[model samples]
Target: MRLFLKFIVVGFLNTVISYILFIAFLSILNYQASYTLSYCLSIGISYLLNTKIVFNVNRSIKSFLRFPLVYLVQYIFGFIILYLLNQYTKIENHIGILIVIFLSIPLTFILSRVVLLKKIQ
Candidate 1:
């Protein structure tokens, strides 16, 4: 429960950063493009916070390399949800992203925990 709470806090911080970047990029790009760019940029911050704060793990080149895979998977899942919501529902891009973010939190935390905490035998 405590770990989950920490993950939520880190996720909230990452979401805020990504949303700001998305809004900035939306000025010149479409929603999909903005989301992609913002998400990619925020992965670094996510990795840092998740490692140092949330998981309390030491940074390693191996873990850093594996980290973005978690985000990539999350991004794909979120993008599909975003697309579906925007295409078939009344939600707009801005609002749809918030829904997607909240929906993705659990999956993100689980994947991140596996990648960050697994010990190589």
Candidate 2:
């Protein structure tokens, strides 16, 4: 429960920061470009918070690389589910995206825990 709470806190912060960056980048660039840039920026923030606060792990090169891989999984998972949701239903794109983001949380938490905490002392 405590670790979950930490995850939520860090996750919420990451989401808000990333959203701001996304909107800012969107105003100056195309959607794909904006998202890619913001996603890359947010990866650093998320990895630091998850390591130092959420999972209490030391910063490591291996963990740093693994962190983005976890998000890549989340991104792919979100993309597939969002695509299916949009195809089979009348859900709007923004709504579908939000749903996909929420749906990806548990998986994100599990995978991140595995990546960050599984080898701890």
The C-alpha stretches of model 2 lying farther than 4 A from their native spots are 81-96, 119-121
The estimated TM-scores of all candidates read 0.96, 0.80
Best by TM-score: 1
List the pairs of residues colliding in candidate 1. none
Q: Considering summed lDDT, which 10 consecutive residues are worst modelled in model 2?
A: 92-101
TM-score result, candidate 2 = 0.80
On residues 14-60, what C-alpha lDDT tens digit does candidate 2 reach at each position?
97887688778878896456656876798899999999999887998
Task: Give candidate 1 misplaced runs (Cα > 4 Å).
Answer: 119-121
Query: Looking at model 1, which ten-residue stretch has the lowest summed lDDT?
Result: 112-121
lDDT tens per residue, model 1, 1-121: 8999999998999899999999999999999999999999999999999999999999999999999999999999999999999889998888899999999998998899999998421
